[model samples]
Target: MSARRIDRRGFLKTAATLAAPIIIPASALGLGRKIPSERITIGVIGLGGRGTQVLKDLLKLPDAQVIALCDVHPEHHREFENGKGPRLGSTPARELVDKAEQARSGQPGKPCFVTGDHRELIDRPDLDAVLVATPDHWHAAITLDALRSGKDVYCEKPVTHLFAEGQAVYREVAARKAVFQTGSQQRSDALFQQAAEIVRNGHLGKIRSIEVGLPPGYDKPMGSTEVKTPPAGLDYDRWCGPSPKLPYMNARHHRWWRGQRAYGGGVLMDWIGHHNDIAHWAIGEELGGPTRVESVGWTTPDVDIYDTPVDYEIACEYAGGITSRISTKVTEGTKWIGENGWLWVTRGKIKCSNAALLDKSFDRGEWVAGPTGSHVANFLNCVRSRAACIAPAEQAHRSITPGHLGYVSFSLKRPLRWDAKSESVIDDSDADQLLKKSESRAPWA
Candidate 1:
């Protein structure tokens, strides 16, 4: 399709339709009642840092309600209650309780129930959907359960810890016929959309390569620490859901677990998911994985706490001779290298090689300004209409595969070819084994 003929206006019109008001009958909307209005009642499965952020965002939508909240730590429940609890009533244990009380009394508040066991949360008949924001290893399993229960899902980025699980997520979403949106919110950002449109329309002619910068991996040395008994209210086994059990350490417990290989994929999967998503969107490949990957750097040599590469470079090849180079150590920004000129974008600035590329201004007179407003608006609209979300599961799966494949290559320290068709490594035993999930510990297993 010609760039100008791509119909930005029509695309925006479709987005507007997807952002239409959600309508539900007052009776159907009653809390503690049947799952109301295909307008999804959402359960947040991991109420830590990222999950809490998602809960806050979902609260803004009029049609959606938080039916349940689940986390391993009791401290998180305390924080959510102390901070947002009293506003609802006296002491509602979960967000759902508050929501139900508000509905009964005809008051304005969020309705959500709380639980430490995510399995109970997923099994709730009141829930129409779930948001999975747990560690990398737990993402696939939780998502699968949510799907099996006939609920739509919004999972955090880097969707799967292993390449093999992507196909499972794909199959489950298709089989259940559910709406799955990946939390790669960049897809909902106007600036990112604009950037991708510019490249797609040949604003950057004959694109050569794209480079993305992620936060640097831990470059500091690991401090020595002794393993301690699991804390009183924290369900350590549940927290380690699909990952192997190890002695308790402060760094691997909460948010810092992103630095570990067992629970995270390091900076590559951690940060690259955003830009790689944009890169794939700009290139217009519907469903393609990287053909080859190689990496040759390390962020830290610490073998004690974390095992992911700290600093590394990876090259991914696609059809039509296009290549994307992602690095962990670059200054945080995204650069597009093309035959005609280049464009660089970060949160603070956007620059083009010719400087003329910046001269063109998008006619946003009719468009929304920020990402949070635009993206959330889109999802709510789709919930009512049963349309596709802007960042659907299939697209997210394709975008994230590059970073996961890159990690696999770096860990194996060899060139690996991937069959995007089969979502597997070609022929190499070690790489093939890394493609699937590693078994978690017992009990939680």
Candidate 2:
């Protein structure tokens, strides 16, 4: 298939028109008691650890059912069926099957269909939404396909593998009027929510700079260079999907793929979706992005095995005089610095330079200005209510832009100014070119 190029202006124009109305279908307007048959049916596209957790959680919801599972690795399905494989912490796939079946109250119900091809699962007419737990590179492509198939999406974070893909995915989501929730679970955390509200309401006085820190990249040795035969029951070709098809490298599959730039963008890209997003959210620019990004990185010296940065720092300046200093070296949290005092917030804890800062409180409506409920539950609610998900496509796209720019700047060895309106690097043609999609492997491009 030839590459499908969507003209930005025309696509977005149609999207605006389509998204103007928040239509709640009559069938979904059931308020009181509803039968299990009326529940929202879901299909999962990637059955990795994260996907398994999402499937299990959906099973726990009384009004949601996961009817299909898809992944290139068939072992995932086998393990779920045979009740064997890597432990999925809390939400195991085997439990998902049992819970889904029990939701039907022991009556004859549809089997939990499993397949390697995601298209087969997404194409199901009964599929109301798809939970995308694929790698960063596959996120946008799978989301576009799901939206085109008229299904809502709960896509994992670092929304797009490539910077250029964000706009296309955003356009398609709006055009299809599909409810999308980017899997940035931090948005649902109450401490982060409280932190964002405090910053936005000027509890920190005049905002100066924001410090965002992320975890280090994969420390494991890169896999052997010797090309090995693809493992049995794994479709390496399909596993690579739109990414380049190369001989099997054990380290390049599954989670370790994040260390490779071709498929993932290291720790910078992985954690930026969470920390940088809070940076943007605190400054009230969730739908927009940074204006300039300057980055410096440390890579594996004299080693080709792992290419992702071991340590990195980026200074991203947003449009409204806000500077987000991001680094792997700093403490893992977001700290807002200002004229009066500073507020620092991490998972489960919030600290401030002034004790008085914590005393200020907002009304119930003034609490967090984003979607409520846990992230997964929020998506299911939006699927039924047609209300916008907190981390919508625009926010997801905007949140990851700084990380993408950091990569571009680090590669070019210079700062790059970005046109948030154009969603491209300004002035330099070469840098602008890097902002667009590269050719994918055959049959997927």
Candidate 3:
């Protein structure tokens, strides 16, 4: 049979025609294999830039197929649906199409289906797993739904917006016995893993403090602009799910959502999660939350566009007097300070307090193989093995807690006492409120 030319609109029409409560049978999806299966049917949610990259990675695996793609933006979906059919190339788009064609030719599997609403794809019996790459606000809800629907999940970093939600998600995953992986991909990189292992093995001596850095924030203010009509084929309401309804701007809609408070926790949660996670791993406390957090710094004076602090020094106190100071404006590198010496690490570079330590190269033989060759690969493997991923939901939630707490301290303009066990601010009602998410408008509610 000739290859199907289903586009985003066509896929949505198909999904609409299908009745509610669609059931996707596990047998039809062909999930799980003794070894890697010939084909692993998968679904893609939130097909923006990150979603597209993930799609490419899935295509690279010989056993995987992108059976369904979903996004709220019709234009974004159209961009993929109207693209040329399967062909070989280094680009993700090419790889996805090529894999789809491979499945259809009877050479291996089946072509992918595209849709606008992720709910449609989640209900598909033909899917082995779903990748949740939506904004931070939507992460917990979408993931919980997917897990409840009996699909394994590979969710993005800083897994939840609030501490309580993280706990709820942890309970849900545990109860369902679903395989879940958080998208803190740095754990899969060779250099990062080596650095973390070195610190954990006590090569860095008694841990003192960790310094984590993030890219600088925007200096200019976002001037007021009139609210224009929502673009065609875009479900703005659905896109803003779990977030307050606000005038649509280029920054809020696309990649710049990181700066917004409702959608993201700014650089603290975005960059600190990776670096702080490194510190957590190195300290051998990867599963627990920090005992305390304090922040000192400020962003631009304007409060219109972004409410998160742009520059700040946040400290996470752990057990045994070890502390990690996560900063957004610091030079790009991780510094581990201990009693004997300090080790500094960044991509392609490593340094030590004693110059001689830098000369001593470590052996790879002592290294334990991580979940996958890299972070994303690890998630895929965990879905099949039912093994715990390197950065599971609980671990990621703890890793980001310091950053979130730091932001709270900065906002409150005081050194707030944090109860790590309770995951709440001690005795402070206002600070306590920040630990939970506010109700979104109707529809999102």
Candidate 4:
């Protein structure tokens, strides 16, 4: 299904000709409710929960077509059914795409190719873009592959599994000059953009400090320790990929992998890209790293299946003179305390101590523009225009850097100094080594 490409892709501008709050919603361009002719062919490589959601967004894009699906696990029609959360792998995603195309075009469209190997999909010559919704560990490797293949990428957030991967991703995107959008959806929301603009344009005056709160460990890590045969539909070995091969456990697959460091980086890495990205956006520090970072009051789970901390606080000092504290124990949002007042933003809401700013439009026209419109639409629009996305690779790498550094500092129970320009830890060999993945991560690392 596709629509004739038009000239509507753009941002709402302010009186000064800078992109400002879009007075009209993204729906005017058919964000999700309508469909137009497609222009960009897409291959989707992880048909799990997040994959399905993003696929829904793709289905709505008039300039994009999802033509391929890949996942280690296929649908089993069980408790964790396909098209839903726990297991809706490749085959099911194929079904969904077909239905959407047919419904949008009023005719059965070309069938989507389904496979377990991502390399297979990337080999397709027609694909102009790839969506990577796999586990955090697979992000950099798959993204690197797609970029090398000349495919634009829309990878899910927390773009790198480890610090070195971040560097690799940033470098590759720059070298290729490919359009890459990290699934930092918050960047596309108007309220978040508004909040960041207000702070950025000096509407909040100078900043005092930032407090970012994230949730604790993702889900309960208390399943039975018994290892079992992986479901027949799952290719468990490929699922583990570069991560250490452990006996199959339901808790380690599907949506539960984040609790372990080997497969996922737990809550710290999980939510870091989100709230922290907003923090960086507010301050116009999208490509910068914290000068120093330390973590304290940290504790990990007792179960061997999980090693990520359940309780922790990370304090980071930046070269820009603003300090940020990120912890699961805080209020679960990004709050900027400024000299004049404060501004806070979370999903679906935005508030400020000086309430007038919320309605002020920050239109004093200092050109504090940021990402606007629907996140998914923003990526597709950039794909067609070959323009830089709202959340590009470097910003994604920088957004999650503090969290990765915090994890290392927390694991070592010490403070570490970071040289932002060099993107390395100073005077700490142990800390520096943690920046890269282990030897087992191999060619991908």
Q: Locate the minimum summed-lDDT window of 10 residues in model 4.
A: 14-23
What would the TM-scores of all predictions be?
A: 0.84, 0.86, 0.82, 0.89
Clashing pairs in 3: 24-125, 67-113, 86-97, 103-109
**Local lDDT at 275 for model 2:** 83
Q: How many clashing residue pairs appear in each of the predictions shown?
A: 9, 0, 4, 7
Worst lDDT 10-window in candidate 3: 81-90
If both were scored by lDDT, which would come out higher, candidate 3 or candidate 4? 4
Candidate 3 ranges beyond 4 A from true positions: 1-38, 76-95, 98-100, 103-111, 221-226, 301-303, 354-372
Give the per-residue lDDT of model 3 (tens digit) for 119-167: 8889987676888888788887788888878887888888887666777
lDDT scores of the candidates, listed in order: 0.69, 0.75, 0.68, 0.79
Per-residue lDDT tens digits for candidate 2, residues 174-271, read 87667899998889776787788788877777798989988887676555446689766778888888887766765666666788877888878888
Query: In candidate 4, which residue pairs clash?
Result: 2-36, 2-37, 2-38, 3-36, 3-37, 3-38, 82-88
Ranked by lDDT from best down, the candidates are 4, 2, 1, 3
lDDT of 4 by residue, 1-445 (tens): 1243221123354211322212233344221312222467889988777888899888876666888889887775333534443447777688888998898899999888988999999988788789999998898789989988878899998998878888888899888777899999988787887888788878778887999999988445644456999878788778888788888776666677888888788888889999999898878788777889999788888777888888878899887589999988789899999899988899998888977787753352344455466687777766654568889999988998888888888878899999988888999988899776454444444
Q: Model 2: which ten-residue window has the lowest total lDDT?
A: 29-38
**Model number with the top lDDT:** 4
lDDT of 1 by residue, 1-445 (tens): 4344435466657556555566655454222233346446778877666776676677656666677777777553322333553222112225544655486559965545677777899999878788898888888888988888877788888877766777789788776666677888887775676677667767778888888777777654332345889666678877887787778876566655767788887767777668878777777764776777766565554656877777777787877777877876555667888889887776647778776556545532222222334555566565554557778777788887777767777677787887887777888978878767556566544
By TM-score, is 1 or 3 better?
1
